[model samples]
Target chain A: MAGGGAAASALSTPWRSLLQRALDGNAHLKHSTFFQLATVGGGGRPANRTVVFRGFQEQSDKIQINTDARSNKIGEIRNCSFGEICWYFTDTWEQFRISGFIDVVDGSNPEPVKLQLRERAWFGSSVKSRLQYLGPCPGLPIPDDDLIKDAHLDPSAGPVDAFCLLVLDPEKFSYRNANAIPWMLSWPSILVCYVNVKAGGAGLLEINYGQAMNAAFKRWLVEVNRKTGPPPQVANGRLHIA
Target chain B: MAGGGAAASALSTPWRSLLQRALDGNAHLKHSTFFQLATVGGGGRPANRTVVFRGFQEQSDKIQINTDARSNKIGEIRNCSFGEICWYFTDTWEQFRISGFIDVVDGSNPEPVKLQLRERAWFGSSVKSRLQYLGPCPGLPIPDDDLIKDAHLDPSAGPVDAFCLLVLDPEKFSYRNANAIPWMLSWPSILVCYVNVKAGGAGLLEINYGQAMNAAFKRWLVEVNRKTGPPPQVANGRLHIA
Candidate 1:
């Protein structure tokens, strides 16, 4: 709530709501050309990777991504919770940078929050008919019809033990326009969001925006949350989303 | 050198020359959409970034790129010398991954390498002008002379101060095709380059039909080096490309 006073003042604007809507209602959100995640490694130097965003949390200021637990990224997050997420919106000529903490969740965990993730896994398996490999590899040998049928005998096969959820709890957020005027370019009007990490805790802070813009953004955030439901929880250092 | 033994036994084909030409003659070498550099950072976590290849050194296995010295990537190289460069050829559905070590050079230093970097910087700045900024204030006074100029001017400005040479002493290289196989769905054979960084700076150990398909790609890498020249060195941890 440190920046709440400033945020409250900006929340009086309608433009904020429009900006928020533009972010959530935009169909091309999933088509970001380059998405980067920066995390502190155990050796303490910052590490980051480009990943596809699976979904967004408008109300909670959260973002969701899917990854294999066996990947190096998971190990980095496990070592350090503080990290940054950057999404380049080429269509809009803008860059959205979010810095926050992350928690990993498993698909088979008993937590109710994980139900949606399990469903997504099932859907993913059905659509692809095989788990995608991360890097280049030799072709998979074709299985006989019976072998193929046998593999699909159980829907659980869809949930590879490697699949996991990565939930980002944003603490600071900024949207930068790279095409802005040269002189006025260094710092554009940015909106920053800070989150309280305690269980069931929520706080919103807006940074450097006019009243109309903040209000518009808040409305959009609320709407996005309503659509996505509550923020998922971290059990055993993993996020479980319903 | 360890992987070189296996490479020699792979195959020898007339297509080797084709692959070599593709690497050395492409005009669009630097502008490829998917160019990535992977370097080891603190704690040994690998870091990768998309970069525009400025040049390559077939003789030394050195690849040069213009970068900001102040960027966090500088810290990454300071911690580890080994790195990997990966290029994704979307048109061909092929990927080339090169692993090597890097060496930073100073542009302002009295070395031939530094002089070459300065020449490139001069060439870049000659055709361009500095970009001026407009006020951030909405109704602030506007300057009549403030206008956008050519982009090439000082393209090396930030990069010179931030840039350093990334000499990839190749330890190993791999070419993989990520496409459906002929007849049945299978992956094409992989062409692995197990280079002895010190023994064969740049020479063909073996080649076959699979590598012939990558002719255009090899030419692209060499083209990058031809155009970019060399990386400026680091003097007291700073680049003097200007």
Candidate 2:
């Protein structure tokens, strides 16, 4: 019955509250919005880089990120939409690991709604930002070591063909606060318990469960069920972070 | 000839200089050494977390990280040694992405030299740091919501069975500085050129070439060769960050 209740609740609201609190606490710092995004690169290796968080998608919980369509990440998302984002807030000494599926909305996306969202995001972007798409394709060697000149894109120009808006629909979330308890959450069925013994500045242990809810995750679920024989409190309907 | 020269030179010295400069510039900040490590998880999705850099291995370029053998990363590395580390310096506004293979040295490892390295690292660790290994298996839920009691591991004891030393043998490195030009390096053969246009506090373009040196990387090499007809200066073995 507790498992059924957890499944019924689906998304965890308490985790969201905690994340919002961290965000609000560190909103004054510009770098607070910067986070590392890791994706499966060619040959199944991990590729990670910093990405700026564009606020949540209009009226929805999905995280928004504006990126160039010509970047390698676009191809990476095409091959495998699964991605993980790690964000650390310096002021609060808090860290968040969010794993999810990234939905790429580029010019070629068939969905009209996604295209409209892309257009709206493009209009919201400054002209200086839009001019980047007009430059040579990213990652290509500039011929003859020439410096890039500024482009003359109009301020009112629509979103360029290379503009893409990525929407990350989160499935699993993990939060760690140096001053408080660490909490983890997953949608529908999966749940994880994690502890990091940070005696010095270094973290001693960390575990990640991707949204697919792989074998280890399933095993963890069974283990939690077996260990907590008396019906876990959070497992019953309400999500708790304490 | 330039390609051969680059191959002969192997590791780029200029990139190392830049990294050392960043390290020296940010040595006062404790979190300067904290970086995000990304690895492939179950179902080939990306897993990322913050890890403290233990410094370069003894007389080697390999990055050192102290971890628990019982952690999920040990298993992840066993499954696939390929991993990437992204280090960002807040004060300097610089970022480094190092891609490489991880060499796991656990209690089960038979190599005496590596074992000695592990022992030396253990001796270097603080007593409070060593006590983490004595705690319950990480990521496993505690039965009945019980808190973890302090572990009383001896300061002079040898490395525990769960203590592991991860040596990341870097094959490719990318560096970005907000105040200067971005540079990239690869060992012996591969070379990558990347440019990120930052506008309004957001990076518009970035690229990653994993160490396996996949197809896209091969094509980039050819493109560089064809474009720079007069033979690139850096390709002539002298590592140049400019």
The 10-residue segment of model 1 chain A with minimum total lDDT is A133-142
Quick one: RMSD of model 1?
Answer: 16.7
The CAPRI quality class of candidate 1 comes to incorrect
The best candidate by lDDT is 2
**Candidate 1 interface RMS:** 11.7
Question: Fraction of native Cα contacts kept in each candidate?
Answer: 0.00, 0.60
Alpha-carbon runs more than 4 Å astray in model 2: A1-12, A139-150, A181-242, B1-12, B139-150, B179-242
Q: Model 2 residue A30 lDDT?
A: 71
Model 2 agreement with the true structure over B121-219: per-residue lDDT tens digits: 788766656765765554333322333444555577799887899989877787655433233334354444333323222121123334353454456
lDDT of 1 at B192: 26
lDDT of each: 0.42, 0.65
User: For model 2, what is the error of residue A92's alpha carbon versus the real structure, in angstroms, after optimal superposition?
Assistant: 1.9
DockQ of 2: 0.35
In candidate 2, how many Å is residue B9 off?
A: 19
